[model samples]
Target: MNYIQGQTALDEEEKEGLLISTITTRAELDEFEQLNIESAIEWTLHKKLKKEQLLSESFVKKLHQKMYGNIWKWAGKFRKSEKNIGVNYYLISTTLKILLEDCLFWIDNKVYEPEVIAIRLKHRLVSIHCFPNGNGRHSRLMADLNRIDPLIAFAQS
Candidate 1:
């Protein structure tokens, strides 16, 4: 959040953390509910996603909404709005889909490592910069869904 003016003596202010925190980057936290979920899983890198619970599209959408409804709250919850930047809109929804598909595919095939999945998910989530706010927190929560983390409890609704 540090800013330096670009003139006599300013212009090299690198944003400390992507979001509002020092350790967490923008890709880290996407949802408030994620912290809770992560905590339940623990520090294990092999944390597994809920395959049964996520089978239903409706269920996933609901979980998504519950996890990140706040982002929509900044504008509209579901439907798109003309007033928003195209990139933001795309990032929010597209990234969500990416998250679901990637995790499912990676886990189902059992070819990918959990750490790899989590790392990729976390990095991309932040890169997308979805949601005007809270994108960072949500990304972290989503990425660590199966892991045992204190933040999981906090991220869950």
Candidate 2:
């Protein structure tokens, strides 16, 4: 579980279920994961999304699965044990439900500008750290899928 200088370390729970054992170095794992995530992004880019669809728990789980399924067997599944980050393992579902409801409310009421909404959603999701790995990337992709233009401008700023 030793992390490369700047890379995040995979905990026992995170790496225990990996499908690809040949990946020994952090760079190799990162490269494979990035490729998998890029493919998921391309797949998501073509889909037409509805507000309800965007707010569903299923959508989030499926998105995570799509982003990391090639690299890990536990992709899309919530962590079963505590990690160095994230909510307690048991709270992930309820916490995510609350976050999604809040997001739905934000969208429904237009409580924030689109850029703000996307940024907040991305930040909250990453804070939740629902998955064993790739929460940051998954959340970023989720934000991008919501409103790419706004997120793009928001990021550049």
Candidate 3:
């Protein structure tokens, strides 16, 4: 496992392609991660989202994959092991499905202000910690992308 600044730890299960020697320092890792995230942001900016896309498990996975696939081998995949945070690994899919449904209802019913919904979604997604790494960033990106319109409508544009 690569130590970030000899303090914080990156996941030990990072892809084999990531060598401690290749990125000896946290600063280097930060730079690489930033570059990857920038590219993902660019992609989101250019691509038009559809309503169906927001409700998709595949879309969430793909977005995470796009954001971190280059940095981690397990980018698009869920964690197999339990972490100190998040629901059980097995519950990820089910919990996410429920969240999506709730989000749909929120949009359909105008249940909350758009900003509140976005913040709520972001907070809940971070809590889920769906990915081995980059969950917070991934969730934040998802929330930002979701702000394009009225909840579900955001995905439409």
Among all candidates shown, the one with the greatest lDDT: 2
User: Mind sharing the TM-score for model 3?
Assistant: 0.85
**Candidate 3 per-residue C-alpha lDDT over 10-33 given as tens digits, one digit per residue, 9 for 90 to 100:** 455544536234776668877888
What is the alpha-carbon lDDT of model 3 when measured against the actual structure? 0.75
lDDT of 2 by residue, 16-74 (tens): 78789898877898899999998998888777667678678899999999999998998
- lDDT score, residue 129, model 2? 85
C-alpha lDDT of all candidate models, in order: 0.44, 0.80, 0.75
- Candidate 2: give the clashing pairs: none
Candidate 1 per-residue lDDT, tens place, 1-157, comes to 2313421111122122122343343234334335534543343234333553442234434444554443233321322322122245545576556665765666566545666766676677555544443344545755665333333232332
Of 1 and 2, the candidate ahead on lDDT is 2
Residue 55 accuracy (lDDT) in model 3: 57
